[model samples]
Target: MTLPGGDGPILTCEGIGLAFGRVQALLNMSFDVRRGEILSIIGPNGAGKTSVVNTITGFYRPQQGTIRFNGQDITGLPPHRVAKAGVARTFQNTELFAGLTVLDNLLAARHIFLRSNILSCAIYLGLAEREDIRARQVVEDIIDLLEMEAIRKQEVGTLPYGQRKRVELGRALALEPDLILLDEPTVGMNLEEKEDMVRFILDVSEEKGTTIVLVEHDMDIVMDISDRIVVFDFGVKIAEGPPAEIKKDERVIRAYLGEG
Candidate 1:
């Protein structure tokens, strides 16, 4: 498919490929994420779904092809650079600063905006104070948006698994990204928590206008929430379309559910 250009997709990966030593993890995989859309990447284990996320977010460099975000080429940029360029991600495993409070973790994500040098931070000068206050305000807003105000001061390590996951998401959002890459956002949650996460994700897309590219195993969640679906099998693109169309795809059924 032709990638959306000036009036098109928010993100696009064309002919992306990755290899580890002699093994190929992805082979000419390609897809597009339209602006203000939720696109889910679904596949079985080792189907290169997570690799695609890593490639897009610059955690891993693709051996071939390119990634474009906001109409600019960003292939192989470092992860920090990618984040600064408005791509934010939450890992499948929550990576919270365990010893820190929820608010502290969120505030830490604003380090990119710090104006005070290490010397000024050590001295706690006027500029340092102002930066600290500004970061805190941003953190507070994120906490309120994620409905974590009740636990803002609580240690992230002491929170429940689901809440820790939410805290991780809050930290990612603190970057104020234009695109959010979610890797299995609802992996271990109970039904209630999963529902809440789904609501939060939809709100983030609808209210925040953040384009979301999700790598998730929960078919129910993907089908219910995704505007489009991309299916992979053994590192190959087997199907790409809306969820309803993907659900009826013969290749998807054979690869994921086995042919009857």
Candidate 2:
């Protein structure tokens, strides 16, 4: 899938550094995410993979480094502003409104696109009504895309873990983001559920042409779905390449296991 913009890096991180007191979470991290490509970030625990996503999405501010998205400097932008700039993210932990229905949770993500004033919304007239209808239509399409029709009306807190993960994904997609960061999207899933999630992720990239930055621990899934893999160790990038090249990297082997 070709995006309107030329084949340039959709997101670029330059010299990113983050520290919590004395522990440095990320150190001089840099990477590029090409438009419409699936880039997977893999690392052992404490390798700072999630730290990178958090910094990019504005959940955490880096002490140093500049982040660019769509050629604009987004460094230190708040989460909502970054989202407004066409970035959406699903957390390593599900962040859905527990008491809300799947549909309502998805609708909440559409708030960023709402253009109606309080008066128009209260009256439910004109642009307000039209925008509400459009939002619902978008949510419905996402529900169908994620195969959540049966549980659309169910409260998220009552759903199974795997299904809740799907709902979180649906909520992110509801924003119609140009770039989506998925954090351990298939974690805690059975084989069947993992397969389903993988198919849905691929569908989003191939059909919607959305660029993806995926953080996953499942090596098999990462190698199978990623166009390129970035490996991190001790808060620094150890290797970056295609799946085949990453699979054979000695540094990656040593990071995951011990030197033999």
Candidate 3:
């Protein structure tokens, strides 16, 4: 993966700091997520990995820092506003609608683009019906891409963990985001599921040209799929490099082992 030079990164963070009461969650962290590249943020627990994602997604605002996406200063924007800026995210735990079908879950993401008024939308008439059909076609394409055809009509809660994860991923993909943030996408998966998830993630980046900011703990998955990595410890960035160099970093090893 050849990174673009001096063109400005797809996402840039500088001097990011966040706190709740006296406990500081993040401090002076900076990094760049290159366009069309998979950048993984790794760290031991309590190292503020999720804080970074929250800050980026506008779930939490940093006291200090400037966050730029596609060269726009988006610091302290709200989550929905951030999402409208072409940022999409999936939770660490599956946040699927327990009673909704898989297809309905994906359709929900597509609903934002409805161009018709409420009464027309309620009746599903004229443009509203056409938009519904269009949205379903896009959702169908996503179902095909994510291989959710067989279970598309099944209730999401009835699916197993790995499959629910796929639905969550598909939901994010449904939004057709420019930059996607995934938090521990393969955390609770078996080996086969993990491999499948990795393949899908890579496909999304390469095939769709979507930039990804991933937070994953599986070292082998991170090392294998990530183009670059930023290692965090105690809310501070300790190392930033390719997988090979990161593997040899003493600070990273120490942080992983809970050592000094």
Candidate 4:
């Protein structure tokens, strides 16, 4: 897409290896996520795509290599700490309070800004009430931007799959993250739904200037949206380049696209 931020990478992952006992989930994986650009990681079914995201967000610890975000070494940081550092992630499967309304679900994601002590919250005093209003305002803007006004008060579980996925993206937006990791955002979506998601993702990157590291299996969409592409296979990175170069890579063809 010829987006900016070629100065340097915002997140640099080098030689990352993580395993569960004897089962290696990711091995010697490396890539760079540029600031304010979309970088998509694509591969076959058991290619350790999610493992890379989990390790970057501190859900899993890698036995080898280091991760640097915004020029700071953030390897092995806790998930909460990672969030505080402006890196957020969405799960491959939906992760939301199903019984809660969409608004409430988004409000819950605004916990970082809940600056109220027990006393102020208990009495609904100055600071607590002010924080509540501010949080609501922020979340409402996200709702509007995501075009989720109709279902703002609907219970999350009652929404259709596409809407639920949209809400999950909204929750991540509520965090006001500098970098967001999206895992399989459009897998089950129909063509129209996928188009809408692509628009939202592009809007978030261009308008808000947020960096995105996406894990998506849809080759067409990934090649269309991503500024850079990283291909993985059997717990290792196979190729890294822009979409055009990656499409013509011999190793990637043999390993991922299976055209060799």
Candidate 5:
């Protein structure tokens, strides 16, 4: 797509291995996500696509290998620490707070950026008040960007599945992250919802200059949105390249596309 940020990768994973008991979820997995580019990880069901995301975000630590972000070694950092390091993610399943309003859920993500202490918050003045105001402004801007102004006050649990997914994305956006790992962002949405998500993802990349790591099963969407595609199978990386090259890769066609 001829995007910018040609300097180097924003995130790098090398020789990553993860195993749960006898099942190896990943094996010697390695890749680089260039700054300000959308990189898609595509594989069949149970191919450890989500496992890669979890490992990168620190939900699951790799038994071996290292993960680096922006020239810093972030391997094995806890999820909260990862968030604080300017990395954010949306889950394959929506992880919104069921009882909270959309606005509140989005604001909660800004907690990592809050500088006020408990005493200041209780006083409701000075730094605490200023931080609160700024946080709300960020949340409100996200709500407007995602077209969620109509449901800002609505409870998340009462919303439809598609809307809930959008809220999850909004919450991740609230982090103002440098890198965003999106696992199946449009998996269960209608065509229109998927289109909207693709648009928002592109906007986040182009307008905000955010680097994206997308794991999706929809080949059409993946091919359309991804600047580079990585294919995996049974915990092993089979191929990696631009969409057009990946489309005709023999190993990818055999292992992932289910063709001879």
Candidate 6:
């Protein structure tokens, strides 16, 4: 559905509720990821931050509420369908193909966009060659954007931890998603790596105009990169606003920083 924002949100989660047996994971979790904007979801560990991402991406179906993307109801859809709907995500852990070369991993991500028949690919037909070239061009572009051109030919497993994370980001971008969900994109990185991630995220939003939904624990990074922030605690939303407003929110302070 079109959000209150004029450009319309690329994603909207309304009254989202989920339960894992007796434990409530999320309740009435509502928010909008505005078109071409970065929306950060922040909370302490086990505050259902990742659950919100899973619910939106169809990894887990919410027992209540609706999720809409580009004005279409996407709730209950399968993960692949949600992905094909222009929503792409990266796991908190780098999920790269360990043995695959960086370029190969990126090509794998674009498999959904490939139309060549298996027989043609196996035989290396003219049509398959054309498809391969097109896919390679896309991968090359992502390499440049993510600054992985130098390592494109290297095996992903041989790359350092920070480079592997970048490869994961590249794989996600290869999906050509309109909205990208980043789950702790900078987690486990050094300060320099975190700075690079923050810069890249901002560049992606500004240059590519891709909407972003980020679940981040780094408050400084979140505050610096996000256009808006959503705070959650005990499975419920406590505050939602711009970075400045959220920083001053008492609920957010109590939930994250403890009583002060």
| List of clashing residue pairs for candidate 4 | none
Cα lDDT of model 1 by residue, 1-260, tens digit: 22223358888899999999988999998888887788999988999988888998898999999999988899999999999899999998888899999988998889787879988889896889989998998888888888999999999989999998899889988999888999999999999999989888988877787888888988899999998999999889999999999988999998885565
What's the CA error at residue 199 for candidate 6, in Å? 1.2
Instruction: Kindly indicate the candidate among 1 and 4 with the higher TM-score.
Output: 4
Kindly report which residue stretches of model 6 are placed more than 4 angstroms away from their true locations once superposed: 1-4
Q: How close is candidate 3 to the true structure, as a TM-score?
A: 0.95
Q: Which stretches of candidate 2 lie over 4 Å from their true place?
A: 3-6, 257-260
Clashes of 3: 0
lDDT of 2 by residue, 68-169 (tens): 999999999999999999999999988899999999999999999998988988999788989989999999999988899999999999999999999999
Against the true structure, candidate 5 reaches a TM-score of: 0.96
Q: What clash pairs does model 2 have?
A: none
- Candidate 6 lDDT, tens digit per residue, 54-93? 8888999999999999999999999999999999999998
Question: What TM-score does prediction 1 earn?
Answer: 0.94
How well is each residue in 100-121 modelled by candidate 5, as lDDT tens digits? 9999999999998898888988
Which pairs clash in the backbone of model 1?
none
lDDT score for residue 156 of model 5: 99
Cα RMSD of all models vs. native, in order, equals: 2.7, 1.7, 2.0, 1.7, 1.7, 2.2
Native-referenced Cα lDDT, model 6: 0.89
Count clashes in each candidate, considering only residues at least 3 apart in sequence or on different chains: 0, 0, 0, 0, 0, 1
Per-candidate TM vs. native?
0.94, 0.96, 0.95, 0.96, 0.96, 0.96
Ranking by lDDT: 2, 5, 4, 6, 3, 1
Instruction: Give per-residue lDDT, candidate 1, residue 31.
Output: 85
